[model samples]
Target: MTNPRQPHQPRQLSLNAFLHDTGHHEASWRHPESSAERAHDIEFYVEQAQKAEAAKLDGVFFADIPGLWAATPYRPTAHLEPITRLSAMAARTEKIGLIATASTTFHEPYNLARLFSSLDIISGGRAGWNIVTTQSEAVARNFSLATMPDPAERYARAQEFIDVVTKLWDSWEDDAVLADRDSGRYFDPDKVHAINHVGRFFQVEGALAAPRSPQGRPVYVQAGSSNEGRAFAARNAEAIFTAHQTLGDAQAFYDDIKSRAARFGRDPGHVKILPGISPFLGDTEQEAKELQQYFNELTVPAYGIGQLESLAGISLGHLELDERVPVELFAGSGDVLDNNRSRLQVVANIVERDRPTLRQLLHRLAGGRGHNVVAGTPLQVADIITEWFENGAADGFNVMPPLYPQLLDAFTAGVVPILQERGLFRTEYAGSTLRDHYGLPRPDSLYAATAAATTA
Candidate 1:
């Protein structure tokens, strides 16, 4: 079958509904339409998934922190586990892909493989795993560690973890299972091979318990933007969930990853780069800015301070909210900045660009927490998305609405039609599986492909 995800006449845009509890904004729960209590409500997510499906979005994505993200009392930081939530969404909605975040730093390879494989089967081939090397000392404590592993060590382990998982996924050939009662054999034993994968971080000696999924394996979605992260995504990721504050940075990243993929002997076109976008929409531009400002105004200063402290790796609690933040506080040598890249880079970008006071900086990050926040009318939002897509800055966007099912509703009801009218996005899903949704080909199992080649 021809892969639906391959490039066709029109360059279709890939959009995902990046679902958050109340929403993406730090103070989203304070909105009249939001409720902290509803964050745990399965029905709330189901409604969100259904709405994305209605708009013909490619997928619904959920990001997880594994531990308490920040001061929970100040902000509603509690969240449902991502993979489990996506499973629940799978049953309630069809067509939209279900993508979940899990950490390589904490999860075992075998268990992670089994979990994603099972989800792929259960979701009828609509599963995608957002591979993440979680960066938090707090999360390390939950896993019985005093400090997080260094970046090099963590990425090394992640590479081995993914290698073992992929080998396990490829162990069971597509034709291994046969429900032939008359022959008295349910499966072909010869077709099922033990991986015997021995890696630096993991070892596995058996086939995955689950058979090859409908898409061979769940789509590999990665979310790392550091140097090692970029290299990792180039080798393995089918889709990347990324965050960037500027168009130039996004384009540079897009070019670098594609070139890296080509160097790895992989089709660069197969790897989709999706930057996160938080759209706070209104019928008019001023109205949109004011609505986003309302969420910013609701942010507790203490919460923002704590967040900045983590990013800057310094004690910013002593700083006055109205006073201009000392730029030199976070200014360090090249080696030091490279050590803590993603969040620090984002923070530095904001600081250098605007040189805001502590209070101003908090509001700046309040919208998408470092992702680009576009507060505008429907046309303005659509135009921005189109500009990014057409200019090679992005393959698509992970649409993060500041408020769940409300701002999300606005984006779909308002902005999506403009994309559809311009023929930049799909009006309806042409295929069923998540791979199909992303225009990725269903790959053959390594064993199956190898055996076929040998026989020929």
Candidate 2:
């Protein structure tokens, strides 16, 4: 019989570690325990993956941008390529899911398809692709465009980008390969096909070179919560990484995404929405707050001001740290607080609701770049997660530590056990593949489905 206490089924929460350099806190590198010097060390990342696996967390995510983010000079910006690093991680860890971000704007569909297919195979189906349309204007210029690609145009291209890539991944049927020595035959010619895809933004001849990867294709994960982004995710994403400051905000976004997915003829349960949470855990609430404050105090004011300006697309040089920002300042910024979509809106809500001083606002965003930042004891952190998970606010969370392995260690050791004892999270991994971890089904190959229909 199954262990009576063992975690079971569809009710469990899915957690992923958002592995940023050093930590999520802007001044984490300056922390005494931070491993800042090893920012570029491959083992630094490998260890993180291993640790998450040890805790039986669902996955580890690496978000990327083609060019330097506007605030590069403020923190440790140097890093290894995500796919390359993840491939290395795949070799070291056994069951942890490996998720890496790749831009639809920066790569050709075929090349991107092959890279993820290889990753899925390398990790025995423990791979996920975090699809993104590059948003920063500075990064766009690096690709030779004088300005950022329009969001609509970028997403349109992204739509086609996934279409073509999925076709390539579906090119070879799972059983297409048969190395029959006596029969002197290789893969069944009938089972492999060329896509012959042509679209508004991309045109490509079909037939991916590789056989269908372990999970058919990397599990489609996305992070945008914009009106456009939600539509895209409703049609494609299996998991979504998002930001939220309150339960109401999270619930509204959750309901919208689920409703949209149902409209697209999808099972709403298949689309897992995970908001980002950066926790500062300690023995007591006061200690947790102090820990958060220590990191905040180390941050540079100039960098925070510059970062705020860049992200919100506004000028803040004129505002004093202690003064309340004028509500009208964000009036023209599209849907800042009215809709919970953009980063600016997150800032707007903080300003409108908390009415925080400029310095307070900077410190708030400095922690997770608009993601929720919580400081509490382990039980408090677990309680927050439980409330959100049970109250229709989230399916899971992207766990971002304010500092590196130290914060990760605290979560796995301190918080996870509470979640486990409460039957909210798994104490051990149930399956090997990422899809198994999240309880998402493996998709049938498009070609296979077509052929099965014809036969019927």
Candidate 3:
């Protein structure tokens, strides 16, 4: 632990704990090791955040959907709004980044920007927004809409949304607040300016009510993998959270995103591409497989079928559980780079390569819903991380444990030490802000630049 690593290294791996209710496994709620009954408790989340911070992870992320999950009938489907819980977490922990999902389709830029700005200020610069275009019609209904917009229209609106929000965030300059008791002038009027944004999807005007946050602006993170999604990320996302099932697929995605970012006149290194990894660990390889099988056996067939049907846009009524799934079912998704249905393409690759039975496919998807799932010892998991990092397959990983506190604890305790010893990951955090943790600099304020130009 003392000398295996050098004093200085060019790049260190970034890791985030992708926290779900009980765990990432569809049947994890049924496992005895899980805290299934306490899903709604704020303390439950606080504990997880503390654990991740203790291990010096880059951050903790929460994926949100306004409506119930498709497999809600089989698991605990309720959730506390991520921002509310994270605000509480901000006060409890220091240094770890706080990221939460919010759909551009459902939120107006003004209110969303204000919300994140406040969180950034409150967290002392450790806030991130995982931008998403909610794809579910069910979720749209919650907002009193009849149907969700098509992907093209949604992405178009999101492009404008990002523009408006960032401008609003920069409405107040970095040194706007004066807080002078002697003069009684709280802020310099000259430092604040109206955004006055007008676009196809929105019209937001005036400066933000919240003062400039510590990071200047919150980090922009994107999770979509569609063609439009990639283009959006290339143009705007500072960090990207994605999923893949193989080294080849992951490597291709890594290269394509970096190249696309460069074409947009953006620094490719500024876009950190972190793929989701769900590993079930044990002391030995056989034990790991057995542990994974334990969770797989707990999955309800109906629930797994519903999840598959949703992702693949196909029905499985005709096929028996043990029968082979036809490769032709996913013929349209052959091009991984351009496929709008990002997750279905992962399943297609799985069926084409391994030729699994319907049941086996279900088991595979259950572990992480098309994210890479590995059942191995801590050493094996470390090898996977190292291989992907060294080979340009990933910048880092989104560690998703199969069960709460237990699996997460296992990862931080077992796998983290290995990563630290090899100098692939940081043994301790060196900075206070989320941007600092991700190796990103605070972005220059747009309004500030405009003011300086006007003065000149």
Candidate 4:
């Protein structure tokens, strides 16, 4: 079968190593492959970043949370702040993009704009902002709110938040910084205009504190699958981080989101939908399955019950381990219970299909709940990625390693070379910035366009 897109000629797949504390699974630190002792150490993260850069991967991403999860013996609860760590990482690595998550729900637009702009400047343009509206109730208390806002309200505020932030980034014209010591003028006041943004959620009447970022703005990345989330991403996200358990699910999401992009007058091709993939690799298929089993066996059932409580919104302690979850438990939920619909759906599907005991379900989700988890040899793993990318089920992937550095090392060393040999991945980065790395066009400064038009 001849494919029209085949002329695209195995477009080099984008890969980002999603660096979690030790690994993506909550119980990974308990595994022998992970180093729990160094989870808090900055050097550990820096080394991971360096490894990704050395492998010539596109970027390294750090997911963040503003509040702690319910105390669990199985999971490490502590984490270093992502932006500060990435700032330190910027100094050590030269090429790989540094992406960090920041929630719009808890932060002011002006401040976030300055933070990411500064990161872009420091990293010489390789910066990405993974925009998220936090789904944690615990986070609300930290921000002096009684409870988390509704998802619809959060998305509304997020839209305005992004609009205001982009305006602030655009406030300082590209040529605003003169740096002409001879004239004793550091900037052109006329060029540095105030955003004067007034919106339903916030009001800021000034320009951003920093100069223009190297890429004009940090690459706008988003990771949400709700309808509101999809709309927001279609309008603003350059890259999307998504999670799905099956090939059918991933393809459905891929088609839906890309179809929505066109309604916003965006080139569907411009919004890269990268599903999260957690691969467990070994010399042979049996060894890989054994490795996966090892991690699942290491999982603590109590912790899994706690996590399942969050997803199902029903305490599982009363239910027998071997009993099937009742469908009635999910009926007519309010926002608190339904905040994570995607995750809830995954749980429902698992319960319906596998009919697994409580103990078994916990093990199934140990490696990253509902995201595609594959246990195979390097060739087998590569085949999955190739099939997904070639079949339009994914543009690429946000690689979630089941264990840190070792799992990452295996993918970069084993799977990456196969991809390169097959011309499905790049041997060297095509450009420097995150935008360039993703083949996205740099947006022209709104200020620049107005000025040139006025002069003519």
TM-score against native, each model? 0.97, 0.96, 0.96, 0.94
Error of 4 at 401 (Å): 0.8
What C-alpha lDDT values do all the predictions have? Answer: 0.87, 0.89, 0.89, 0.85
**Per-residue alpha-carbon lDDT of candidate 2 for residues 199-269, written as tens digits (9 for 90 to 100):** 89888897887888888878899988777888999999999999999999999999999999999999898
- 95-207: candidate 1 lDDT, tens digit per residue: 88999999999999889999999889888899999998888888899899999988889889989998889888888998899989999998899899899988678778978
Candidate 2: Cα lDDT at 388: 100
The TM-score that candidate 4 achieves is 0.94
Model 2's alpha-carbon lDDT is 0.89
RMSD of 3: 3.2
Stretches off by above 4 angstroms in model 2 are 1-10, 334-341
Order of models, best lDDT first: 3, 2, 1, 4
Clashing pairs in 4: none
Model 3, position 168, has a per-residue lDDT of 91
lDDT per residue, candidate 3, 328-396, as tens digits? 988888553432477888898899999999999999999898899999999999999999999999999
Off by over 4 Å in 3: 1-8, 335-340
Question: Model 1 scores what on Cα lDDT?
Answer: 0.87
TM-score of 1: 0.97
Best by lDDT: 3
